[model samples]
Target: MSSAQPEDGLPVRRVITADSFRALKFKLSGARPAAAPADPVSLPQPPAPQVLPQERPVLAVPVEPPAEPETVAHEPPAPLDVPEEEPPAELIVENAVAAMPEAAEPAEAEPPAEAARPEPAPEPVPETAPVVAPEPPRVEAQSSVPNAGTTAASSPSAGFIERRVVERPQPEDPEAGKRAHALLDIMAMPTVGSLPQERALANDTLLRLIPRMPLKSLRHLAERVCVMESPSQLLVRRLINDSRIEVSGPLLEQAMTVDDSDLIAVAASNNPAKLKLMARRRIISPALSEALIRSNHVETLLNLLRNPGAAFSIESMWRLTRIAAGHPVLQAPLVTRHDTPSPIAFQLFWQLPSELRRYVLSRFLTDSETISKILTMNAESDGAPRKHADHSLLSELEVTAPGEAGAIYAELAHVGRETGDRIAEDQGGEALTVALKAAGLTRAQFGAIADKRADAEALKAIFDTLSFNKARVLLTYWDWAARRTGPYARIAAA
Candidate 1:
């Protein structure tokens, strides 16, 4: 290597020689040197660096290759080819590189020309590509529900319906049952009144609970609510339609909350007993009367006729009179009803027994012209089928009066005997006269049967005043009134 001092007082460098360049390549490759040559080859040495008195002498410390780490079961690395005191050949090579001129830097040999790589054949492009809809991303959703089958989040199969298991009704809880009973009791308390909303809610709850309540509980509830000053209409309607009479009777017979529309609906049923209870309502609308009459229930019709509070339309009375033409027991009340139109009463006059006919003419018909027309119609209808006599009257007595049937018969058998006294004692003068006349006895026999002087006078006057036909009508009227006021009224009606 050669050097010069520049104007900047820095050492200038010259080209490195071939031998130094050869040594650098060998040092970098970490190759062992060949054996020394037979003749020593001398090489030019570099000039020493100058140092001032204030500067310390600079030493050219050699860089040794890094020691390969010791590894287990591995041959020890070949001993380094370096002396500890002498500078390493690699260090001299590095100094040579640092001093070399840029122009004299050895050129890297061009790599042997890579076998000419042929240009990749351009990829063929199709002239036209089919347009396809992009597929929707699939989401694999894991169902948290146990035993549930996985379903695709994308398009579901057409016509596929997903079904879940329907839960079964659970057995009623004891606590829930107790709560229901408590609610019923609370609502039933007379002193307690509910707001409309509360009452409506309570009615809905009760309707749900009704099918579960026993007949006794239902009947008791019916009794309680029927008498309430303001009862739930929904509750009243449900109870009135109950299958059991005991559960429904009070509501049908006495519940003020029961509407005429409700009664009309109930009258549509085939249940004659229900109709009878409905017949006994304090007031009945014309529509309901028509419905009851349409029932053609003989007993129900009788009760309706006996109910003075019941109003009958003209058409209803006309229909009822036609029906009464066949049911002899219906004639008395139908003809006597104040609401019975004069025309309807006149039409029914021919069908009634002699006693009821007399009662109808005396009470229902004051018009002389109407009376003459009724008599003419009666003569004309004589050729028509007569209304059947009520054989059920005695049967009804046996059923309604029970043990009293034999006494009634015995009183008719032996006049002025123990039977007559028993009759007078049990029933009053009016009753004895009715019984005698109804039994086809004369006014004289009724007098003989009368054991009390006051009864005999009053009853004789009654006997003289009322014809036999009218007495029989009174008899039927009294019988019905008794039965209505009796314990077996409902049974008889049923």
Candidate 2:
């Protein structure tokens, strides 16, 4: 064993035996010393507790006491012996094996007395109990019935399921018609005297109510409101043109306030009935009659002609006469009209039916000279010459004086006779024109030549060569002749 010293060390350590060195080494390593064996006589003993063999063993966990400066001895806790809650019966049966601790000796265990008490029996239900339905809601009665006039049949009831009885309203009193008429009278009065706006409103109200009124009421209202003196021109005009003949008749016949322009416009409509009604007015202006005539309404023209108060211009009369030719219904009125021009009357005479022709002949053709003139004029204008020439009569006339007049008459007479049955085949236009000019004869005399000849072709030739004025006269005559003979006559002649 040796001892050694290191630098900065003041003392040297001595080496010991191996056992002692090992013991010291172990002490330096901070390890616990080995426990010594206990002496049997010094050991303490615990008291014994008795337990049943079949009982389950209890498992307890040991707990250590907390450290304290002053240590006190604590007695081991007495066995708790507090009874544990028993598990539910169902659980006991289901887990009887698992819930119980195993015993050392299985032969010592006891069998369960009975299977788990049978589950409690369920309560029984009765079969005779009646099923009660819920009661319906009650409605309170109304204190009083509502007035028939105040309640409407169409009004909704208060509740969705509730029913209501509605009474019908009473009819109006019997004097309702009289009351309505009186009201209408009151409304119509303002249409004349009130402001224009008020008048318009009154007129509108009257019109709205008029359609609902009876025929008698409408007539009465129309008579009172549609007069010329009234200020309601709009109402009067509406009434005048109303589609109802009764409503418009009075206004058309006597509405003096109707403007001439309005009358003309109505005439321009060519509504024969309305125009005829207007023609019956107390006084129709020439302009109005002219417009009426221009409409070419046959009945209207007849009405105007029959209206003594209506006057016509010469041109209008001529126009009316031309129109009257196609309308046999217009002939009688035309003939009877005092205002009708002599020429127009004469012209219409040929178009009159055979019965009316007598009156025309007697009235217009009083003398032989006038008869000759009319017949001659008619023939010339008609462009219808005779088929056979009467040259014997011409030869009987003495041309005592060889003057231009006598010479022209003789030449025209000769040419007319030459244009006999074969005149239509002959080119007599130039000859007829030369003869007429040389004769210095009027259109009447020229027409007579063509008429006497009985050749339409020759007449047309003569007409073509005549002056514009003479040709027009001939055209008018031809038109009259065509009408005088029926359409079949023209077709047959053709």
Candidate 3:
């Protein structure tokens, strides 16, 4: 090693090879060598710092991503097929012969290379398998699924499907059963691998493996997992977070029945991780929430009209509708708008009695257009759709001392929406026709809808059939009044 301070007062150090050290041994004595400079460079400012752009960040405008460093070459990994050790040719030939005795026998006259060739040709045996098997249908999918043996044709009939549940005897030796179960559990798990739909089979295998399984196995636990879904989600967080998660399905249903917002909020909280956990895991479906909301909705009156026998209550609707009133996801449900209740809502409100209807209508029906529409509809169409009611039930029930009447056109039409009490659809018209028909009220009994729709002349005749007093009021006074009020005033009167 040679180190020295030269003319510029710069110290430099040199490491010499063994040859150079031996040659310099005679000239240099045992004096202490000078220390190398902290930073050695040809130029005083340093050799441009090797211009490593990576070490120093760019001083320009900040961009989304910084520039990358230059890449250094790397060696590729060795091929996987390459074995750690190569067998001797003789040993390989010996093994090859042993593996394919038939092939070796066939080509015994030639070198083993020819025999190896014949052996490898057997790879095409799979393709030629059909010719050998003679019955392709009997061996379908044998190559891929590898002997499933299960077949649609061989499947047992309805008798097998109708078999009742049966119990099996448990192993008497509990310890032996436990070990067997544990061993079988490991083996079966590898095949099933936590697949979504393999649960039943996996559970069956699990029970079989643990021969000491309870008579009902995990049936109760399984049923609870599926059925005890939370309705409120408020208690769900607390319940699932606890070490002992014991709760009934009906209770969970009650909990989940609340608004989704409350559910999401409760789930978001740390204390109630269960709801959030279920949401994350997707165990609770979106459809379930939607169905629950729908179940609570008002349901269009038309549907009720079509199927009068189908009576559905909307009790839970209050909480669900109030909470999810503004959520866009709740649009499909027949819930009234949060800001402006819909026509059906108004109808429901109006059904609350004269005083309540008047108050609600006055408070919320502030929109003149809406009010005008409602009032006009109340006059022209009454309650029934314009078209259907005008022809079918409208004229018959229109004069029913106000409240006793069936749906009438004048009750629901308004503004430019002269849709009348007309059925929005012919099916609705057909439904009304069917109902009237089913009621056994014919054209003669209820009068033709056309007769009801007729000008003053036809309606006058209908008045003639009923009591003179009621008919007179309906005929002359009602007719004159309907005309005098400009149709709008008649609804106001009602």
Candidate-wise lDDT, in order: 0.56, 0.51, 0.32
Candidate 2 residue 20 C-alpha distance from true site, Å: 99
Error of 1 at 85 (Å): 72
Q: What is the lDDT of candidate 1?
A: 0.56
Tens-digit lDDT string for candidate 3 (1-494): 23356798544544232222222322232333334345332112211112222222211222233222222113232223223464222333333334433422211111111122222221111111111223345532222233434453355441222223344657655354345344334434543465534644544444454334332332233233334333113323323333332332222333344445544343333233233233222223443333333433333222211222222233323334343334434332333333333333332331233333333323443333554455346446435332322344444564555433323433322112122222222222222232343233445654454354434343334323333122112222222333444432333234
Q: Give RMSD to native, each candidate.
A: 29.3, 34.1, 27.6
TM-score between candidate 2 and the true structure: 0.37
Q: Highest lDDT: which candidate?
A: 1
Across 151-245, the per-residue lDDT of candidate 1 in tens digits comes to 54344653443554432444444344444556666566554565556656666787677666655666677777876777767777777877788
Rank by lDDT (best first)? 1, 2, 3
Per-model clash counts, in order, read 2, 7, 38
The segments of candidate 2 whose C-alpha lies over 4 angstroms from its true place after superposition are: 1-208, 226-228, 346-393, 396-494
Model 2, span 116-234: residue lDDT tens: 22443222222222223456876544423454342333445734333445435444344433544564455556444656666556557655555455656566666765543544676
Pull out the clashing pairs in model 2.
Answer: 380-447, 385-454, 385-455, 386-453, 386-454, 387-454, 408-439
Two-way TM-score contest, 1 vs 3, winner: 1
